[model samples]
Target: MVPSPALDTAARAVPRVRPAPAPESAPPPRRGRRAAVVLAPAGLTLALGLWGIRRQNSMWRDESTTYQVAHRSVADLWHLLGEADVAHGLYYLLMHGVFTLWDGGLLALRLPSTLAMAAAAAGVALLGHRLAGPRAGLAAGVVFALAPAVQRYAQEGRSYALVCAAVVWCTHLLLSAVTHPRKRTWAGYAAAASATCLLHEFAVLAVLAHGVALLSARLPEPLRWAWARAASAVAVVLAPLAIVSQQQASLVGWIDDPGRPELLGFAIPALVGLGCAMAPSAAAGPVPLRALALPLLILPGATLLAVSFIHPIYVDRYVLYSYAGFALLAGAGLEAALRAVPYPKAGAAALAAVAVAALLPYSIQLRTPQSRLDDPMAAARAVRELTRPGDGVLFMPARRREPILSSPGEFRGLRELALARHAVPSGTLHGIELPAPRIRARMLTVQRIAVVMDPPGRPLDDTPQERMKREVLDRSFRRCAEREVRGMVVVLYARPGAC
Candidate 1:
């Protein structure tokens, strides 16, 4: 059977039913706009990232962990990883290099995440343009830049943004391999998938997403097997990290099993992604948006949430790359919507304005400290002003020591009453504290103590150590000066007559 003479020489026969693939349904030409389409949203993301990069110079609990851990010497970092966060070893090493080159404090800490999110926006735009059109691509990129979740993680010091970027670009690479069918392309895809899984093991979920995409596209059997081989290679390469990180899973024991709110979170956005994915695309590529975006948007989050019932590793940020798929669908949906309406250009402009108006308040809120669960800097200020020389400070649950650890010099004048070993040397998040008897003995000698505690009504830790701290404080000391700061309760305790 001879190939159709009208089929372009460059594009391969991706499907037996179709004559050609990539160029078959291309929209009317305004060529050479691909670079601009990718760069535009990326620039917007970078601007949004830099707009309030400092978050009023406040770092939250996780950011504090990143900052302090990344600053450790290589030996200390490696040793610490063996004990605490082996999953984050690569990210910590990357951050260590960033800090070594430029000690810009908060700026250095979070800039990598911001830049990586910008890259993700670029990837989304390129993908949207390939499937829908330049307009859809540009819109998708901008939407990604403005997404509240994207904005939230973009300003943090973490690996999720980088993982998001890798997933988005690798998805684009998957489509490229489908149309072009080159060993180099598949190799790139496998390599990227491996790197993404290395960044965080949860990204293996994206591999399952790609499988859904390939099956849904109904591509040729050869293509499916090729993808399978590539995916298998990724899984094999990731096996070591997966095995090692299994031990680390217990580190996130704090995560609760998915509940009603988790269901609502996945269900609502999932419906929207589905609608947009099913909408018509004016510019069509080799792959269908429904086949690609819907699975990418739905599978990772839903699977992880479901798995949380057994292992409890679900986190919204862990599947942050899902937003790229949503952005792609949204851009295509907007384009299809405008095409359906009269006076398309006017509808597009009006839609853009409406989106900006609706998102402005949330955008403003994203730049503030209140956007996160808690701000450590707010409590650090209280600690700085309250402590006098010769005072002793006690972190009731030990993890409450985060604010002082974040701001190294803040606790200078006060002795750490409960700590037996410092965090860096002990290779722990918070330093190891004394046994219950030792803590009680230390407390008995202090005339004045500053007790750092969690906010009211959080469940108590049922350990002997906590029982000792509470009983000794209640029995021997009088609360003198008490202040409530963001995420913390700082109280001054004194011997019965000292106050």
Candidate 2:
């Protein structure tokens, strides 16, 4: 059959009607690839974070406090926060929920931090990708997951790792708002920033870094103004929490002036970050990335350290979020170095090998019980062995009560001679102490007493109650035995000649 000449001519003229090559769309597939690139690093981070997470079956003093506080009834937690640790109230609530689901010992206690650290690594990768490229992001995330300080906190059962994760995401959200100025984006920025601050009041310092990012950004006037508004909103939302945390500032009285070694330790990361920012590849990346990363790396810790000269509020873990910036900068530096080399892929593999080799010893150390200042579990075990039914336990200087609090079961049979109330009842980390006269009176009555004290050379706590406790013990009792436990001393005293 012969087709009509007009129809045949039209079909030939239509160029075979090839369906427009499927509209050249690959959005879904492209998105899926991007998600894989981001998530693979996150998964690696999670695996690394969970490694040796039990920390050799040891619990430090602070973790013990976390365990005790988180295990409390919700009503008791609320009451306790009113008197102390208002700074950690939200974290305690989160941990309480975690323990409620699975009270599976240290694993449950430390898992939240491990997960938070993994999230932080993912955010670091995303930030690096946004600033530079995917390779840089992956490298940064890997570096962060391997950092000694990061690994240390990842295994700790505390709010610092959570704060680090929140601040990293907040930085990412700030970048998003800068790039796409919309009400929803700005609101998301505000929420992320607020969450960071709420996680730990010290994390509010990260806002200064965000300000640096905004100021350096080449965004339009309206976007800049929107950022300012968002920053103000975050500040306004967190004001009450700041005020409450400040009221509890005395809790940090134990932080002494950072020594030379500590200062040098902090300087290493800051110097490395600054060097990366000043490197040639730093110019190749988005200008705002260097601006953002540099300030985030240096400002929080530097500001805290400078202020500590007058008020002494500096603690390394308090500014753990700064490490994220260090990771990003290190990633950029490595990429820059590799780009300059003759063979980039080989260069990258070599650099990574060097990093792992350098960090291996420290990584191994981080998993040991001696990694911490002292093992509260060890002290508690010693106390348990020394104690007898009806004997009294006395915490010298009051703060030494940490071991007892950590292993409450071990000390259950012994009376707490100076305790005014239990921690939950007294709304304190260590229960409130009885009056000096009462402490002395109780010490006199006990036929045998176990004393938990700090190692010698720790400046003596000269409070009236501590003085009274020493006076009574010296006058009425003779030392029967003294045992040195890691980070503590346990001494047994009995009525003269009773030993």
Each model's lDDT comes to 0.86, 0.84
- Tens-place lDDT per residue, model 2, 25-136, is 5567656665665786678768877888888788888898899899999999988888788889899999999999999899999999988988998899888877877777
In TM-score terms, candidate 1 sits at 0.92
The 10-residue segment of model 1 with minimum total lDDT is: 7-16
**What overall lDDT, based on C-alpha atoms, would model 2 receive against the true structure?**
0.84
lDDT of 1: 0.86
Error of 2 at 379 (Å): 1.1
